[model samples]
Structures are given as C-alpha cells and as structure tokens.
Target: MDKKTENFLGIDVGGTHVKIGLVDTKGQILQFAKEITASLRENPLGFNLAFVEVVGKYLAKFPEVQHVGIGLPGLVSKDRTTTLEIPAISELNGFDLKSALLEKYPNTIFHLENDASAAAVGELHFGTGQTSQDYLFITLGTGIGSALILDGEVFKGVRGNAMEMGHMLSRGNSRLEPLIGRNGILKIAARMMDTFPEEVGQLAGQELGMHVLVGAASAGNSIALKTFAEVGEILGEAIVSTVRILDVNEIYFGGGISAALPYIMPSLDKTVHQYLSPYYLSDIKMQRATLENDAGTLGAAALCFMD
Candidate 1:
C-alpha cells in the first residue's frame, strides 16, 4: 500500500471513554467514534480482552486500516507491550495489550504510548503553532501530565517513563499535580476566596469548579485571577527545574485548564524568568496548544506516524 494513501486508526483511552479516529496520512480524521469505558468493563472476557475486541470492532468497520495506535493515560513498559500503574483502568495494569492485539489481528500493526507523549507527537504533526523538533509538552487538566519531544521523537528515559512531571516535588514538598491539578486548583480558589471574602461576587454561593473559575477570571474577577496566578507560580517553579534539566527552548501547554492560561501567564512567566538564567531564556516559547479538544484523538492518530 502506498504510504500517502494508507489510512490508520488511532485510539485514545480514557477512564470514561475511548476515542477512535480513522485518519489519513495527512493527519485528517476521516471518521471518529467513541467507546464507553464502563461498557467495556461489563464484558465477561475482562477489560483487557474487551479493549482488544475494540480494535476488531473498528477494523470490521474500516477494513482498509492496517495500522492502529493507542494513547494510554498512564505508564507503559519500556518495550511498549504492557501497561503499568494505570490509575483509572486498574484492569489494564500489567496487561500485555500488544500481544492481545496481535493475537486478535495478526496482520495489523499497533503502536502504544503515554497519552501526553501522543499529544506531543500530535502537536509535532498537526499543531497550528508548529512546535520545534525539541520541546517540552505539558497537559494541565485533572492531573499534570508531561512528555519530552527531543529530536522529533518521544524521549523515553532509561525505563520508558522519563517525564513524570506531575510526580515532581513543589512547595511544601507536595507533588506538582496535587498542587496544580483540577482539585488542587479548586482548593487554592477556596483558600483565596476565604482569605478575601469581599472579592467573592458571583462565586459567593456557587459550587466551585473549573468552569466557574475560568468564567470568573474572564469577567475580571480578582479572586479568580489571583487563584490562577498562584497556580501559575507553583507550576512555573516546577518548569524552571524541568527546563534546566531538559534544556529545551520551547514549551506547549494543552488540556482543559489551559483555557485559563492567559490568567496564569503573568505569574508563570515571572516565576520562570526569575529563576532561569539568560542562556536558558534566550529563545523560550510558552503558549497554549492549538489542537484543543481534538488533541487526544488526533494525538492517537499521530502515533501511527511516529515510526
């Protein structure tokens, strides 16, 4: 089959749903579908087998696709054959997913990667900003996920899970994710609101959530802006260490919380610049990723192009 004409399947596995995309070589998703994670768990064969069945389910629908790629939410082995420490999908932990896929579809090719790494690959191939060959990619959502793209490829450390930035230590020696992740951000907002009760207008009685926080920030609410600012500072401190270790010139931010990046940038930029030397700061680029909502599906598809 001609490389240019071949189509591939990309699957983004999440705790709630699995997003599948039939994509062409040009990074266009020709067809897209979703599989509810809960439904898969109901299968008697178990979640691992049920997930393997998902590939066949799609292959039967699109027989021409010979290559399939999956982006997993947690750690994958160095050989990329098994999943490890998957918090959301415990059934997949230590499961040899590659062997299952091969046994079910002997003729097809499959690629698996950390979801964050897949997103970085997606940005490399399909992003509007056109990320550089070497850069750090971070996703800010429920948890802080990160991946390193060096020389146009995912940098798997000695054990295949190198960039676990969320687990890095921050203020009070707390993990980075717990400090800036969704729940953590909400906690910060609550603290700020309690400290300055006068600034809590629309947020006075409403349930605190990311949507409400972002909305309040957009409306020029002082408390919301301050919450994001503090979050940014904490995140920035982590980035300072990461950037120094990686020595990368560009960085891209993705995921839902990134929508409030404008509110966070002021403090984030300040913190990074204050800590980094001029050498590391010369050509640094930090901006929101352009793929937006399609990042997961498109990123999974991008894995087919990695080799």
Candidate 2:
C-alpha cells in the first residue's frame, strides 16, 4: 500500500509580492516564502509560471503538497478561469488564471478565489466564524475589499459579486475607494498637505499615506491625525451603511491599512454610532482584526473545502 501524503498549499498573489505556504488540513501554515509579485505585472502570463518556480524552490522537499489554492484580489468567474477587472491589481485582469494554474501544477488540484473572499473563508473557518453567524471581514490595504459572512458561509447575493462595500459612495461624492481606500487616504493626505503647507510642511517633503499619517498622528501631528480621523469617518459611514441594513452581529477589520486602526478607531466609532440605530449598536459589535496577515493564506486553503 502507498502512504497517503497529506498536505495543502496556499498562495496569496498581491500587487507587490506573492506569499506561498505549505500548510496543514487544520488550517495551520507550516512553511512559507515570498517573491516579488511585480514579475506578473511586467509579464502578465508569468503569474503562474513564477508561482510554479517559487513552489518548486521552497516546497521541493515537501511532495505532500498535492493540493493548492490561490487568492487573487479580483472577482473570479464561476469557472475560476477569469479575474474580472479591478482597480488595484490591474495586472491580473483578463488572465486565464484557472488554465494557467492547471498547466503549471498538473498533479495538484488548484482552487482560486477573490482575496477578500479567501480572507472571509479563513475567518469563517479558523478565525471568528466559529463564534458568530453573521459578520463582515474588511481588508483595509492599498484598496479595501470585503467578504460578507451570513450563517457561516460567504454570502454571494444571487450573483457571485456581493459585499463590495469598499466601492460604496460614502464621501466627497466620489466612489468609496477615492476617499476611504489607501489611495483615498493618500488623496486626503495630499489635499491636507496642499491645504496647510505649513502644518504639514514636513509631510510636504515627501509623499503622504497611511504610514506617514500614522507616524505623524503618533507624534501628535494634528494634520495627519485629522486625516486618519477623516478616513475613519468615511470608512465607518460606508461600513455602517451596509451593516445597518444587514444587521450583522459583528464586523472585523483586517488588511495592511488596519494596522492603523488605533489611529482611526475614534472617528470610525463616532461615525458608526451616528448612523447606527440604538437597537443595532446595542446588538452589533465592531472590532479590529486579530488574525493579521495569515487570514489570506488560511482563507485560500478553505477553497479546498468551500466553493
């Protein structure tokens, strides 16, 4: 009899880097490595090719990795062949993702999903869903993406594209991305620097963004502090718009931008409170993401079990 080598692999393909993991069925990431994702942007067809190389290099000794999954930042066609166009990761648009992965790993079963959906799946299975039925997982990175969890599974309204709160119109009469997304935060910071050149003179010497804003806020820079507050306000209002309607029990904020939650929570809470009805606030609780970066990988692995 042959030994059944049991192991799984999860890959997170982002705009800047790729994270590949050899993992366990219990959702624990056992080994991982990263490479420049820019290779795909320059050579769109190289996404999977590069993945294969990275997987070969790192997991070469772990032949148990017979199954693999990927998390992309765009909507996936029902067939998993397409990465529908998205604003942030433009390189993956129109790529024949499913076929490419299959071609690269003929011996492995590949599962692909939207990164937000992957994160929600991870949260549902390993992070938070074990405790609650209804929750929303928000990824606050360069761009905001989210997954809606209803009754323990990802809620895709009739069509697969639902829970796109990041694109909601909540501020400046512009789409949510321009005001609350990372670029939106940068936009806000740039405008602030332009408006108060002296107050933000130090910021004027360089580009403005979440990192700079967080630093300035931490050091008591009023302008940057105000910018983070504005982001929190806009983001909170947008989130409230969706949560109030869904009446979910909780919201978990994650992603790169979420690292600055401490800087934005005040305004976010204020806005959430203002828009939420007394009954809703009393029942629903908003909190920061606890899983951190692992949500993407764990979520990607879940595609092996979930649609």
Candidate of highest TM-score = 1
How far in Å is the alpha carbon of 272 misplaced in model 2? Answer: 1.6
Flag regions of model 1 displaced more than 4 Å: none
Candidate 1 lDDT, 216-265, residue by residue in tens = 99999999999999998999999999998889879999999999999999
RMSD of 1: 1.0
lDDT minimum window of 10 residues, candidate 1: 1-10
In candidate 2, what are the lDDT values of residues 1-307, reduced to their tens digit? 1113366777887777788777776777888777787765556445555555666665466776766778887776766667787445665677776776567667767787788988877776667434475788888887788888887777767657787777777655777876677887887887777787778845757666677777888887878877888888888888888876677758888888888888899999998888887887886667776668787787777666664
lDDT of 1: 0.92
Question: How many steric overlaps are in each model, in order?
Answer: 0, 0
lDDT of 2 at 170: 68
- TM-score of candidate 1 on Cα atoms, chains taken together: 0.98
lDDT of 2: 0.75
Clashing pairs in 2: none
List the candidate 2 regions with Cα displacement exceeding 4 Å. 1-6, 25-27, 41-61, 79-81, 86-96, 99-107, 128-131, 194-207, 305-307
